[model samples]
Each structure stands twice: as C-alpha cells, then as structure tokens.
Target: CIWALVITLLGYVLCSALNPKASLQYTFTPGHPFATGVEIDYLEPIEWLPQSHDQDRTLGAFWKYLAIVLSFAAARDWLMGASRQERRSGDGASRFPGDRMQWLLWTLAINAAAVSLVGMLQRLDGTQQLLWTFTNHINGGHGAFGPFPYRSSGAQYLNLMWPVTMGFWWVLRRRNVARRSTSHRSGGDPHVLLLVLAALTAAGVVVANSRGGFLLLVGLLVAVFVLMMLWSKRQVGFKLGVLAAMLAVLGVGGWLGGEALMARFRSEDIGSMSGRKLIYEDAARMAEDFAVLGSGAETFAPLYYFYRKKDPAWNGYVHDDYLETRITFGTVGFVIILLIFLAVWLVPFVGNGIPAPPEFFLLIGVAMVGILIHAKFDLPFQIYSIHHQFVLLCAVLTSLKWQRG
Candidate 1:
C-alpha cells in the first residue's frame, strides 16, 4: 500500500510536469509493439516552460519517482509471497496465495496514508495560496480549487476516489447480505448503516462540483437501480429515492452557496474550455502525419513547443485518455491499453451468473464511470496516485469470486 501510494503521487507529479496543453499528442513512441509503421523521436529539452504556477509540470517528476518505488515494493512482495506459498505447497505458484485480497487491502491502506501525507505537505508549504491565483481563471470561479499549484486537478482526483471507496464498501455489504440472508439474523442495522453511509458518499460526490464526477455517479445509480428493480430486490427503490434526495440536497446547497451546479457548464469560453478544440485539432493532425509508430514516448512536449505557431501554452498531454493513448502508443498500444480497462470493467459481468449482485455491478460500474469521467477533462492515468487506485480497484474486485474453495 505504501508503495502503491508513492507510485500514485509520483505519477501525478511526472505527468503534471509535462506540457499539459500537449497532453494528448505526446504518448506515441517508436520501435515498440505499437510502433509498427510509425516514426519516432526522443525526449528533447524545452525552451520556455509554463510559468503559471498552476500550469507547471514539476509534479510529474514526483509522480514518476513514486511509481518507481512502488514497482519495487510490488516486485519484492510478489517474490516473498511466492516463496512462502512454495513452503506450504509445491503448486503454490499455480494456486491462490494466502488472502491475496487482504494483502492488497493492506496496500490500499498505505495509499490512503501516503496521500494524506502529501496533502498535508502541500498545506504546510502554502502551495494552495499560489495555486489559487489560477482559480479565478479556471471553471468560472465556482469550483472548489485546492490550496496547491494544481488545485482543481488535485481536488478532482481526490474527490473521484471517494466514490471508488464507497462503492467498494457497498460491495462488501452486499456480499455480507448474501451470506446471511438465509439465516434471517436481522442484520438489519448494519445494512441500514451501509445505506446511510452510501447516501452521504453520494452527497459528497455531488458537492465535488465536478460535472463529470456528478454525471458519472448519476448514471451509475440509475443503472444500479434499474438492475435492482428488474431483480425484484426489496426496498432498493426506496434506497434509490434516498440517493436522489442526497443529490437534491447537494444541488440546493450548491445553489445557495452561489456555486450552482450549472456554473461549470456555463463556461462557453473556448480558452476556458482548456482550449480543447485547438489542442485536439493539433493532436489529430500530428498523429496522422506520423501514423504507425508515434513521434516517440514523451516526445510531444518539445515537438509541440517547436511547431506551435500560436498557442505558446502547448503542453505534452492531449487531456483526453483515449486520445492520449492513441497519440502516445499509436494504434497497437492504444488498443491494448483500452482492453485493460475494458477487461477490468467487463469481466465481472461476463463470468458472474444471471441476477448478479448489485454490489458487483455497482463497484465496477461506478469505477469505470469515474475513470471515463476523469478521462475526458483530465489525464489521470499518467498520475501515480490515480493509477494506484486503478490497481487497487482491480485487487478489491477480486473479492467477488463466487466461492473460496
């Protein structure tokens, strides 16, 4: 977990250091599996970096370092686990190791601890004061910008994780309910508590003020409720109504605070939209020019700086995950990367029988929704903390296996 968190933070730091404007066009590299028919370039130096404290990519280096450290820890743990299992059973390599999910949960706990530490570090150094200067320029002043140089991005990242955690808890409660339903032990209070907590979590989701996150949650809940109704689950309709109430409360609160939910959408300013059209146009044009193999891994920032005629703010990333993957990994790398996410999201539904547990679908559903949501407005996979959550979600979902034996 400690390692995972480090990876997560460092990944964010590294990604943020690159040209954010060029975010989508920068990922393709030459000579790898995806490099077929593609040309490549190596990483080059930049002449002028973005001076807007909020736009600087120094954090990208931090994220890169964190990912390296966590990778080491995961490798070490895998080896040790393999050794221990071998002592107990010769086929340990082929069999499930002792409490794989528990070990992963330990890693996740580490991630939470590490993130809290980083959050504290930012607070102590007064990074928020510096980052807030950009807040006036971002999202129409209605968003909750953090105290860092990358306030909005950081806050959005953290807020998205809240739902992922809550969804996991929902899965846990559901599994317990399934196991105990036959006994009629009146495990009612705990179930009630779970619903209450889930409601509060849904409320937090809304207060995030991120249209992407809010919409993702709404879509997820709708799907979950529909499935529940179809399955004839008792009281699920009421539970969904409560969830609706939570959203209403958040909307009303946002309005009263003068930060209405629609504020994010009202930013019709092309520049305010992060200059997305220009960025996307440039990325698409460049990718086609260098089709097959990409310019190279992490080479887009310098190229963008060189070729850019108007937008001096060009960063390496393209902002959208699908586009980033496409430009970075080319077609082959793009497909494989997408398959990873698809497999993670869809496997549970495929293998699980009819009338799947609400928890099973909801966890995967909300998580994918969060990933897809975050993907559109920001490039999170490049961030270590966000990536850590991805891996942790995969580990947590393993618990849904139908039988221990």
Candidate 2:
C-alpha cells in the first residue's frame, strides 16, 4: 500500500509534467481500465461522494485518495501485528533507525529532490514536454515552468517538501555526528546525500517564482527554529549550522533564478480583484451560506459559478483550501477533518515516553504546519501531488508507534 501511494503520486507528477494530457486519463466508464492498463477499481468509492465529481480528473483523484485510506487500514493492521511476526520470524532485533519508517522518509526526500531537479531542468533547458506544460490551460505562457501549468503550483508543490527534506537532512546529519559506533540503520553516508537533497528542494522552491511558496519556505524555517528552541535547546550550534547551510543554498539559488521571482512579486496588483481574489470573496459568501455543513465535497467548482457574479469565470478551485474546506465541509466537517487527520501528530506530544522519537513526529508536525500555511494562501489540495504527499507523511508518522501485536 505504501508503494502504491508512492508510485501513484510519482506517476501523477510525471504524467502531469511530461505525458500528453490525454495519456494519463483514467476512465470512469465503470468497467474500463486506466490508460496504463490497470483496472479501474475505485469508481464505487468515489461515487459515494454526495455528488459525483464534475470532472474525470477530479474523480480520479478521489479514487486515489480512497486507495490511500484503504492502504492505511492495511498498514495499521500490519503495525499491530508486527510484534507477533517479529517473534516468530528471524531477526528479533529492534527495528529502529533505517526501518521502514526511516526509509519512507528517505524515499520522500529523494522523490522531492528528483521532482525539483526535473523542474529545474525544465526551467533552464527551455523545454516543454507536454501540452499546457507551463501555462495552465486557463492561462497561457511561453516560458518553461515545472511539471505544472503555473509556476506557483510547482513551487508550492515543491514547497510542501520543505519540512520532509529538512527533517531527513537533519536526521542524517545527527546520525553522521553520532557515528554510532554500532550502526542501527542500513544507510551509510546518508547525511551528505540528504543535505544535497535538501538544498535541491529549497532551490527548486525558490526558483519557482512563487511569492506564496517563498513565504511558506520562510515560515517552515521559523517553525524549525521554534521547535529547536523549545525542545532541543542543547542543539543550539546545530540549529545555527543548519540555518547557515540553508542560507548558503538559498543564496546561490536566489542568485541564479531570483530575478524572475522578484519580477513576479513586483508585477502583482496591489489593489485589484484579480480572478483569484474575486473568487475568494465569493467563496467567503458561500461559506456563510453553508456555514454549518458545507455544500458538499467536489461541489465547489459547480457551485462557485453561481456565487461568483463579478467575474463569472467559472473558476474550478477556491484558491484557498481553508475557505474551500469551510465552504464544502461546513464547520462540522472542517473540524472533523482536522481531528481525524491531524490528531495523530498531537497524540505523541500529549504523552510522555512516546517510545517513538519525538523528533520524527515533530518534523511531521512541522511539515503539516507548512501545509496549513500554504493551504491558507492557495488550494494545495487542488493538486494531487501536494495532497497525497501530506497523506503519505501522516501515515508514516502515525505508524511510528509502540503498538505491537
């Protein structure tokens, strides 16, 4: 299941960036197979939504998320029974440092680096692999962006990895410093590799030319600083070192690609109802009308058309995830969403002797905070890669527990 989710995300990112738009379609025709020949096995689950998703792509995303949920159930069961299996199977040694959880983190960090590298190349090489490569079909542009239609989407998607990359980088750095006379993990020289990946991820975000992404990156670093001061006060020098390393990476990255970013920021209208701001105002009105229980999942685009009178552009997303949640899920649904998904991060800190490393959960929590911050400014959830990465992070963090058969 872990692999299924990972491949699913990577495939979407790849297809979105390079494949012809028509090539990645998963038919909703009930019995048809995906373009990749895999059977379409998830229509029923997605159909359970209050209203059918208006588009095939959106419906496909819903199915993928449902698959992740089912996979999570299987993973939880396995975690519960892992102890029994360990006692019966060979190798009773404890699983720590380089276990599945750690490797998963590494996978995410590496995957992020790869994604950033592709985007960087796309920008520098002046190539467009797919139709609507840089310009969202809604908007048109000639320049190369990342795997996304808009540079901001690509930037924010990469920005979502800020915590994961930094977290893994820090973990490996600690491991290298400890040099644990007896190695508990399988990875060797991971610290340097991780540091490189972290730099790549940050550089990618910075070059995407997204003001919001830049703000999110800054916010994440501040979060790391606070976490360090409150929890790992002894690591003062380490924190400073990480900060300096990050600064150097960003300085170089900014030097290479920051002119476009500066131009983008300077070009924004200070007092104007750009389409997004207009949509936001209407979404706020929709939220008030549906304040108790949101209109419904997947209903935003269709319903937004009615509310948005000024532009009447039929915008597909609300631009702000928090507002979208409130408008779709309503107040009750919004709170439930938080409790179900976010509660895991809080549970570890709620108790002492969590058995799991607080740092692991702390990193996950910090990453999540980055998600919320980004969500506030734009609907990161509208992008499959951004949304699924968050789910994957939560699952990995939640699985790191004392639960045993």
Candidate 3:
C-alpha cells in the first residue's frame, strides 16, 4: 500500500513536471459591468498526466517532494532497524531500547524552551528586526516572532514542541515512580524541568500574538488536561498538578502578551477573517474552472492574479494550506495527496497494537491535530521548518513498535 501510494505520487509529480505546457485560457468578466474583461491563460487539464502552467516551478516543487519522501523513509528505517537490533541483542526490557526516545524528547524540550524564551523576550523588547539584526519590511516587522517573520509560524513550531514535552514529562514521571519503588534514592526528578519547559513553551505561543495559534493552544491544553484526568489512575494529585501547570502557563502567557492579544481581538479585523473569505471565494472559482488539473505546482501566486476580486497585489499563498493544495494540485492531484496524508497518519496504527506509552501517543496526537487545524487558517505546512518537524514526528510514529501489543 505504501509503495503504491509513493509510486502514484512520484508519477503524478513527474508527469506534471515533464508534461508539455497547456494552451488553455480563462476569461474573467469583472463583477462590475462597467469594468473591462480580463483574459488569463493557464495550463490545460490533461487527465493522464496533468501539466502545470509553470513547468519549472512544478519541477522544483517535485524535487522538494522527492527529498522529503526519501528522508522520511530513511529515518524511519534507521530507527526501526535500531529497535530490532536491540531486541535481538536482549539488551532492554522495554519495546524501544536504549533510552533513545527519552533523549529525543529531552532535546526537543530544551530547544523549545530556549526558542520560546527568545521569542517572548523579543516580543517584550518591541524590536522590528528578527534576532535583533535582520529587519523585516514585510508586515512592518510587527509580525516578527523569534527567527520567523510571521508570528503564527513561530507559534506553530512551539505548539508542536510543548505537547511532546508534556508527553516526555509524563513518561519520565512514570519511570521515576517505578524506580523509586525498587530503590529509595532515585535523585531529584528530572521530569520537573520538562514540565516547566512545557509550560514555558505554551506561554510562548500566547506571546506570539497569533489569534489562530492562541485559540488552538488553549483548545489543545484543555483537551490534554481532560484526557490526562480521564486516563490517570491517581485522580486528585494528578488533577491538581495538571491544573496548576495549566494555570501557570496561562498566567505567564497572559502576563506577557495578553494585552496585545486582547487588543487584536477587540480590533475590527478580528472578525473580518483578514480578507480570507474573499480569497476562498475566488479560489473556489479557480478550482471550478480547472477542476481536473490544477494550474500547476507552486503557480498559485501567478494564477491568483486572474481570479482575485479587487486586490491587485500579488498574493503569494492561499493562506489555507488545504485550499492551496486543491488549487495547485487540482482535484486528481488533491485526491492523491489526500490518500498520502491518510496513509502517513493511519499506517502507524495498522499493526498489532501501539507499543509506546499511551501518554506519548496522546501527546503526539495532540500536536499533530493542533498543526493540522492551524493549517486551515494559516500556511504552517508551507513553511519548510514546520513541515520538516511534522515529517519527523510522523517518522518517529512509524518507527515505534506497532507490531507489538
């Protein structure tokens, strides 16, 4: 199944890249009758092998897609091979050998904490330059967060990390509790640092001042807390701890950027959808026109010029990743992409049962769900860093012992 999906995607992309350009032209009649008609030309739809309007861009995108797929496969194979070797050597009792997962979680947590702290400090300092050096003219530097020009992108990265940090803390806590039963002296709990980092990372998302990120972070935290309460054996202490952690996160976040966030919400543009509705409406028309084959890969910016309602500015992205996929990949390519997504997400659960701790799965699931939801309102998936993090997480999921109960 995996091979079939991969081959199909590869063929689709290769065909789109190599196929000759189409000569189809779309004529646009202005909404106002007094306005002159505009004629726009784009790639014609070919059922067998779709052609992109811009062959070079499509070819470039194909290379990127190929690299991501190969990298994911290589990473998954290496991790899984290591697990198999450990089991054969009879070196560990756990399904995953050598505390590698713990190391990975620790690294992610520490890095996220450091990045979150920097982003928060930057927000407070009111600097238009990213990293206090590279000035961003776009969005007038107001949207700068961390190293990213867009606050939402920074929020997305932090959002992905904090949940994993929480899961790591849970895993460590369980191991420490087990060790304490065998030996009284188990040193200070290292998991405390992870919990603190998780809270700090969550606070970073709030300080990012992205409305979508803020809302999603709150929803994820609430959902995670509820899940933890339901699954935990020791109810009262665990509940209190989780509640306190959540409060600290929210309180810190509020203290840092709550005023700015509130001001954004109070602003008239809060309900305006930031003109996304118009983009969606125009994109729908474009999709209908090229319903079979999309204009081309990475050609939305150029194609949008013909479909835009009133804005003359060159729109770079659809903002909504899913919608952009549909617009650029067309219905056929969209279905192929959809299948690939389903396979990536569902394949890890297809074997006997999940061998990793349920808490780890739950937390990673929260991170994945949060990012996917965020993609609907922003371009998180389009950003290479966020996309790479997502792929890495998926690879980690795939490498786990799904064949074990």
Candidate 4:
C-alpha cells in the first residue's frame, strides 16, 4: 500500500514539474462557460447523475485523479489487510511503516535543504522571476521557493515534514529508553537532525512570508508544545524542562525576526483576512446554487466568476478549502467528505493497533489534524507537493499499526 502511494507520489511530482500551478485556462469572465478543453468526461455515468468533473487534464489534473485512486486503494488495503503479526506488535514497532517513515523523512529533509537554499538565493537577489516557469503570477509573488512557485504551498509542504520527524523522534526515543543500551539494538536519536531540518523549514516559511502559513506554523508550535507537555510519558520535571527550552527557542526566533513577522501581520488592513471572507461569501452563494450536485470538480474558477461580486478582480482559488469543497461538490459531496475525515481521524483510537505507548498514536493523530486545520484557512491542496503529500499521509495514517496495549 505504501509502495502504491509512493509511486503515485512520484507520478504527481513529475507531472507537477512538467506542468506547475495547472489552473491557467480556468481564468474566464463572469457568465462565461466553464473551460472543458480536454473534456474527457472520464467516468460519466459511474458517478452521480448530476456530479461534475474536471475542466481540463492540462495541468496536474491527471495527477490528482491518479493520486486519489491509488491512495484510496492503498487505504482500503491497509484497513482490510491487517495481519496477526501487526495486531500483536503492541510495541508500535511496525517494520514496514517504521523504515518507510525514516526514508521519507530523510528524503524530505534533503528537499527542505534544497528549497531553503533556492529561497535564500532568490531572496538575496530580490528576483521572483528566477523560478518564473514553476509559478503563476499569483503564487510567484514574493519569491518562488523550491518546487512550488507559491510561498503558501512551500510553507505547507515544509510544515507537513514537521510531524514525520517529531513522531519518529518520540517513537525512537521511547524505544531506546525502554530497551537496554548494551543490547546494541540502536534506536538512535533524530532530535538534533530533525530539529535542524524543522528550523530550516520554518525559516523557509518565514522567508516565503505567507500569512496563513506563518499563522499555521505558530499554531503548530503551540500545539506540539502542549501535546508534549500534557501527553508525553516523560517525568514531570523532564516535561517542564522541555517547555522551558521550547520557550527559549521561540523567544530567540521572535527576537531575531520580530520586525518582519510583525510586518506581515500589520500589513493587513483592519478586519481583512486577505479577502478570504469575501471569497467565502461568494462560495456560499455558489454552494446554494448547486446545493445537491456541484458546480463541478475543477469548475470553481470559471463558475466562481459567474457567482462573484462585480468589483475586485480576483482570478484564483476561493482560499478556504472547506468552503471551496462545499461549493465545488455541493451538500452531498460535502457530507461525504466530512464523514471520510471523521472515519480516518478515529482510526487510531477506535480499532487501531494497541499503541505501545498510547500517546505515540496520538502524536501521529495530531499530525493529521494539523493538516486538516491548515486546510480550513488556505488551499494547501492546490499546491503541487502538498496535494500528493496529503494523500500519502492519509494512507500512512490509515495503515499505521494498532494493538491491544
């Protein structure tokens, strides 16, 4: 299942490299018909009678569908393919996922370094056009960071890496502490490397200067801190010490970049959240228009204009993912989407393998929740890397080992 997910991941990455942003032709005037360039109508009667489909397969569209199919297939396999070995592995040391997690973490760490380097060069040179081919004007604003042309996508991609490293760090640390040191069964510490990687990713987020990304990062830090403080199996004194250390790290980061961070928040106008609320308002009307069936899957851009207000020339995503999904898929689709999320979120606790230390499962659960929270404020799904990354993470979460403690 993981292999299937990874293959699809590579497929998306290559597809995205070939065609970035992928929504160019969706730009159209109000009352204009939705673009249906490649118009295959891939799976017509197979879907609901009135359900809509993609506008074109030009930009990363195929990747989206392919990734979804593979991911869901993997998820299905994971849920039904549970083995006796897995059920009894209450120590939370599932070989497949554990090895796969380490490999993916290192791969992401390398990617982070490359992205940070590119972003640094772009920032130093003050040239957003260096990575022009990879980004659209909308995402190409401040600086094109790494694979993504948009700062928000880059930040979100980097943000997702945090949980992978942190989860393993906790798992390995527990394993090491539980076993004898002289046993020579090494479950070495990933803290120093993962921490450095996280710092670099956070710096990239700051350098990208995405308001929502910045907010999400801050929220993530707090969430992780609170989780560690409250849920960690470490002694109380150790937990307090961890808290003090994290506070100092935050204080230093704020002190170093206080002005620029403040500027991002201050640059906004009063009561204005990047005009997202306005988009949501428009999306609400669209959701009503197509209450049962949706406007279409990727039809939001063209369909949005028709439902949009006269002023403010905006030609991009609705920004809010839930609202966007609601508007795109309508009420029925929205309900189904909500149910799927709830089902996955409950996997760890409901019937998942008995966690070695229960909180370990909770850590992974938090990672999933973080993305869901991030999705509410911005279009992380639109970003190339993050879109597929979410699919892969979903598969991982679904297949994770659960046991009777």
| lDDT top scorer | 3
How do all the candidates rank in terms of TM-score, highest first? 3, 2, 4, 1
Can you write out model 2's per-residue Cα lDDT over 1-405, one digit (the tens) per residue?
Answer: 334434443343223222211112222545432121212221322221232223344355456656766666665444433344456773655454435455566777888778777777776776555332433343444434566766667777676776676766665556565676334244445455776777788788777667787778777767776775575567766667667767866786687678877776677562452457787777888989767645555557656655777665767788789898787666765766666664656444452221455565676677777777778777788777777676666656655553322
Clashes of 4: 5
Between candidates 2 and 3, the lDDT winner:
3
TM-score of 4: 0.73
* Residue 2, model 2: Cα distance from true site in angstroms: 18
Which parts of model 1 have CA positions greater than 4 angstroms off? Answer: 1-127, 130-163, 175-206, 236-245, 248-261, 270-272, 310-312, 342-358, 398-405
Residue 210 alpha-carbon offset, candidate 1, angstroms: 3.2
- Computed on alpha carbons, the lDDT of every model, listed in order, comes to 0.47, 0.61, 0.78, 0.58
Candidate 2 residue-pair clash tally:
2
**Clash count (model 3, backbone only):** 0
Off by over 4 Å in 2: 1-64, 74-93, 128-138, 141-144, 176-188, 229-240, 349-354, 402-405
Summed backbone clashes in each candidate are 45, 2, 0, 5
Residue-wise C-alpha lDDT for candidate 1, range 196-287, written one tens digit per residue: 44444344444444555556656655665564445445756445644564565355434432253466657665254557666776777666
Instruction: Give the Å shift of residue 78 in candidate 4.
Output: 9.8
lDDT of 3: 0.78
lDDT of 4 by residue, 1-405 (tens): 334434543443333233222232334456544343221323323233334444342234545756675766665465444356556664644453344445655776667656755765576566666453433444325546555666677777767766555655566555655664543233235544555555555566666666776677778778777787776665664466445545544554455445666786887552667677777777778878777755555567765655678326444687778777776556665665566556655665565542445555665566567777788988887665677676666655665545444
lDDT of 1 at 52: 11
Model 4 pairs whose backbones collide: 352-402, 353-402, 353-403, 354-402, 354-403
Query: What are the TM-scores, per candidate, against the unseen true structure?
Result: 0.58, 0.74, 0.87, 0.73
